[model samples]
Target: MSLDYTSHSHRPEPDELVPSRYALRIGEIDVLVISDGVLPLPTAMLAHNVDPAVRAAWLNDMFLPPDAFDWALNVVVARSGGQTILIDAGLGLDPDLNLPRAGQLVRRLEAAGIDLGSVTDVVLTHMHMDHIGGLLVDGVKDRLRPDLRIHVAAAEVEFWASPDFSHVSMPPGFPDALRSAAKRFVKEYRSQLRTFEEEHEVAPGVVVRRTGGHTPGHSVVRLASGGDRLTFAGDLVFAVGFDHPDWYNGFEHDPEESAQVRVRLLRELAANGELLVATHLPFPSIGRVALDGDVFRWVPTFWDY
Candidate 1:
């Protein structure tokens, strides 16, 4: 029998929902969750290392599409001690890439009443494209907040800016592009750049903790004030990683080390009741980690209208 493929008469036009933006109060600090956009990746690209059966089962159990993974690109704005700080720059204005739906960070920021010039600092959790892409305007000269102090992990800057980084095996031109971008960023914002080698306060109540593995200088940002704590976990764990902390995606520089960091950080967050703001979780990706038997589960923050 043939199936009916005609459009229904009463069907309404699809609504173009505005991007998500959320604000959270962490003690004395205020954090705004700005949505850059969503990135739809192949499920296999994320779970390539997992056994096919196990991967399929996991997707089935979660009621997720077996062939697709919808990942969120979230950037954070933290306001504390009279300082407005941006965590990671969203994908910048790159028209040639496949990320047409992405790179809405600047517009979203404006919608949220945040002026780029008013931003005092931009803390880079790592140097990945998605995390740092929003820094530049045309991929060459114009920068978003060039005068703002740009804080990055020393190790990250050293590795990505060095000749050794070109030797790292990556997609055809990934390394070269990354190197070029990093150099441009460095040169453009050199005067305002600050590199930290150890875990230290980048701003009042803001701490940068090195959690390498995903990249040479991957790190998480910790915000503390009035006994309340929230962590900006940059690419530390994605959706599937919550159930299987050891499952490594294709992007990690060192899968084993990345897994170790995930496991250790999950334990710490769960035990301490610290709030986690994952960059790649669903929109408004603020949550708490809860220990579930041998694994961990993500409990997203309750929405307050």
Candidate 2:
């Protein structure tokens, strides 16, 4: 069975410059953060509520361009007890959305030696196109188990049924694209949808709780084992959120509520000191929150090899 030859070329496939996955542990749970690549978005999307000059100033302070930048799409895989859970799927179409990059979840998962059928549960943070599009790709459904359980908040499913975009400031075509994607996803996966009202535990120490702000049924997953803990804050908190928690991201369905939720979560995380990872933070977004005088701060964890 050992048929490997040492002569294999070192060149990487699947764009293996960094190989796209990070692994860590919390007590008995095994967690993996996978990069689905990055999406290039307008700088305004970072904070639509702030004055243009203020937004530009913050970007300048961070040494970033005042135009557009690549926002990472992070996906997580966790193994607790015998269940293999997928936190969120990445965007699957690139050119279709005018996003020439991203949608690499499927390829990256295979590169990391994870078989699609092995995933026992899928916990969607919300049904946004970027978060659920990877599952709608052609032939992707075939690779999944027929009995697979997809856990999502009941409000999330209902919101997409009649989505309202009056509050969001997304780029043109995004709202339409999102609606189509959500409708198609529901049609294709209705049989496996496992809707939860407020919270659900997919595996030991892995609990997903609804936190309505980003989306009506938006949720976050928390893992606690022994004394270790981590929270996967899906789209609720962003990189810029630390410096300006009230500044509204363009994607939030309810910007006011989202800001409130952001402040609350940031305060909680700052107080608890548990590890934090977010869907839109940088790749392998393992970090902690800290209250830096007035605004919050993001303290990233050093990479372990």
Candidate 3:
């Protein structure tokens, strides 16, 4: 059955009846997966490289809507070595794109007792607005620790200087909005940024490594402690990516390279048998990857309270 989604029905309320945040531990590191809500994007955004008929068939098999569906916005918080790190800030409020259901990161963080001022570091997988917009919210900077360090890839910051949208296939005004958000973030937080070449350890077991594909400097966070492993894959992997590893996401700047990155990462994860969490994956997105013949499979872990 096709789903009929309406903005009003999905609008955020003062009190949420559904789950918003999930708490999990990677050995010793304290990890919290918080929902920034969901973005109702067009189905075309999922696999722009595929034919409409094929994409629609896939969506039907998955039991999702034919037009648009809510893509979960996940943000991660971790504490290690006396440092509180915020990984990929959530989408901030008041977007002109009519995505009012999203941008719930700040509020949800507050509810989770995550004080902005206590954030010692911010690990960015990239400079995309969705991954960095929460920090751009009004007065968020003021609330954050003045000594807070924002870690990102040097290539990512440089690319946004004059971002190339010729390779992207986004909705109307999205290109401009993304550019604006990235520009504003760098301008306001330039001094606070800590650019790394390849990889850098943010905390004891938390490392951010540059993996260029989705963008010039798309990165992923690897948390290893006491033999436990979990990786926060920013945008390189998506729900549709498992069956259609070659499918090009509209938001990807280099779709060809992105497929390469997606395949490599998926193979590694599948072999290593590590837990995985991603920004756009389903909430709490805690799961493992399994090799299913030539394709891959998503094995979402059972919820642990």
The residue pairs that clash in candidate 2, if any, are none
Per-candidate TM-scores read 0.88, 0.95, 0.95
- Residue-wise C-alpha lDDT for candidate 1, range 1-305, written one tens digit per residue: 00011111212223435546777667888888777888766676565567988988988998989887678999888887877889999877666567777888887776566777778888998887778888786632343456678888889888776635421334456566666767877787778878888786767898888888888788999999899999999888898888988887766777778889999999999999999988888887888999999999999978765
**lDDT for model 1, on a 0 to 1 scale?**
0.77
TM-score of 3: 0.95
Compared with the true structure, the alpha-carbon lDDT of candidate 2 equals: 0.89
lDDT of 2 by residue, 1-305 (tens): 00011112223364466657777888888888888989999999999987999999999999989999989999988888888899999999746776657899998777667889989899999999999999987899999989999999999999999999999999998899999999999999999999999999889999999999999999999999999999999999999999999999999999999999999999999999999999989987999999999999999998875
Q: Model 3: which ten-residue window has the lowest total lDDT?
A: 1-10
Better of 1 and 3 by TM-score: 3
| Candidate models: Cα lDDT each | 0.77, 0.89, 0.90
